[model samples]
Target: MQTTTLTSTWPQTLCDPSGRRQAKPRNKGCTMVIDKGIGQHAFADMLSTSGEYIDIVKFGFGTSTLYPLPVIQSKIALAIKHGITVIPGGTLLEAAVRLDLIPGFFRQVLELGFTGIEVSDGTINLSRTLRNDLIRDAKSMGLTVYTEYGKKLFGSRIDVTDFARTAEQDWACGAELVTVEARESGKGVGLFDEHGECREGDLSHILRVVPNLDRLMWEAPLKEQQVSLIKSLGPDVHLGNIPVNDIITLETMRRGLRSDTFELQQVPYSEYMI
Candidate 1:
């Protein structure tokens, strides 16, 4: 019965810019990590070390199907014990749905102790109605439903209106959060350009239209992208697709402990600057 705590002190130069929100075990501003088949010991270590910063852990792509069932079960249990939700990637679900094994997939996932589910069409084409139905079904099964937006491809452009519309619809259909997919590479997809840089105009447009930015998770796998997003969206903007090794680093950036975002809280007329 181990639990992780957010004990890191806030940097004096960076104030909490997210306003009011739940600390941990929270519903908003959640960080969902994409796991790429790390071993049980490594997973446990991650939980023991940086679990406080992680809200959800997704078995990236179809990696869950590749692992031994026992390993998956143990990982799920460990994550839940740390108060973090665990789930298989949406591509696996899409495969299950395509092969008509979705029912079996959900049953096995629950039996294995997963606390959440991601409904995404990154590698498959899912109609809006079907996606909505899947979200409803996942919610009915008592799984925290995290739906995703955007395709997994090079040069995938995000339509601000479409993204905003999908976000609203998914929330209405019981999705806990809507992920903006940048894939594992975090480049040439969603709002990210080919070099893993975020397109500011697209981000600004989405922010203007999307009612609650907290419900949107940007999949930023690169440090530069993470720094930029955190600086622009504040510490609590939901981010995903983070590499396993960078969990602590991302937390440091969020808290302004890292030099990249250490200047988020300068006074309007600072004594030093004046």
Candidate 2:
């Protein structure tokens, strides 16, 4: 009897249809996963299978706190082993800010091996001064800082002018990346309508304001939103708040392995045959 074994380099004929997906240690096209209490074994399995495609893992909302310290530590270690930057969700930080636990919060995350932290005021009104201070503080603690723009509200919208201004300010304050909020639903939020559709005009306005897409991550948790983004911005656009189960599916779309974006990145497979 004969059996087949697969290796990372096993297939040479197949390539990304778009031919534009960035490799690890990449500066752009980042995928941030929103982990909402996945167990240790499942997380390890996830890392084994899909960590390469994930750049950042955010323990969704305040769920990380719900886990035992040892469990959280183990998860962080697994992520670090896979070369993925992990962070507690921004809401966790907001809660910490309100409790005046910012310093200890930074200390605890650092001790737990989180390589990054997100500064966001999605649920609370975070003042600009405090926001800047938090970014600087996180940087001082030697943590990678990702700031978020826009608020999380039912009918909230992005004022393009405000977004442009705040994005620049975030960069100036040492934010490595600024994620646009779409909440977990990705509807009636920044750049999206109640129907969960992309507001192309607002998106266009944002594109005009930003110098490049490399530093901006759009939180698009829905399949339609993902399809729209990859189609509009190509496969290199950074996306966040991705559900854990959908990582590979989203990657397929980015690579044009899915029909929705197959044409966007279509390439001749024979071109790679040798």
Candidate 3:
């Protein structure tokens, strides 16, 4: 999808240090919303209001199964209309892997209008061979494959070196991006501590080691985590697991319209000219 052009109350090129783009840079940064079964009507409303800022909309966890077929279809259709990529959450894919339903999962995903797939081993163990195979299968079927690099286990901290390696492998396997899991809670998992604080040192280490930060999605559901990541990585870092309602807030932060990230933007030079 092109970098969105938003019609706003304020001028487009006003205070933004880096001007808004004709196409939003996904590698530079994007926002992925984790939806836990929002009704199609509500989903449509959200898209209408803030779809420009949303790059990906995930039917979170296994809740996609809980919705009626038409509802799921409607939501996917809504997202596609706004140029947003839609996919079922990694956990659902993990469940399919657990039940030996991989074939059916892919067919159904395409049938239901999902344009992408997430291959993850959060709750299940997938061998290296199986992981690569899944990526190849998804790609062969013309699906965008997004692999995740961390477990959903409670005490699972990132093994920085392992993550760096897996990210490279996933990209080579045709995955679009590697998501670092923080689950819904965003506590005690990946780079987050139990108190929902980011492990700054770990994040710094990964930033230095990982060849490309643009190919990663950080699942940060908390406001503090959002602020910290923006501070450390700049406003355009890809953030995932965002609540359905917080879409605007995140967008504001990215645009430097929010105080949390206002400092990230510099004053426009035109102001001084006057």
Candidate with best lDDT: 2
Q: At residue 124, what lDDT does model 1 achieve?
A: 85
User: Candidate 3 lDDT, tens digit per residue, 10-47?
Assistant: 56555454454225435566889988977878888999
> How far is 226's C-alpha from truth in model 3 (Å)?
0.9
Residue pairs clashing, model 1: none
lDDT of 1 by residue, 1-274 (tens): 9998988986644444323334698765567788998999999999999898889899998899888988888888889889998889999998988898988999988888888899998888888998889999989989999988998879989988988899999999999889898999988999999999999999888888998787888899999999988889888788888898998888777765667876654345668786
lDDT of each: 0.85, 0.89, 0.87
User: Lowest-lDDT window of 10 residues in candidate 2?
Assistant: 6-15
Which order, best to worst by lDDT? 2, 3, 1
Kindly report which residue stretches of model 3 are placed more than 4 angstroms away from their true locations once superposed: 1-9, 15-26, 269-274
- Candidates 1 and 2, the one with greater lDDT: 2
Better-scoring candidate (TM-score), 1 or 2:
2
User: What TM-score goes with each of the models?
Assistant: 0.89, 0.93, 0.92
Reference-based TM-score, model 3: 0.92
Candidate 3 or 1, higher lDDT: 3
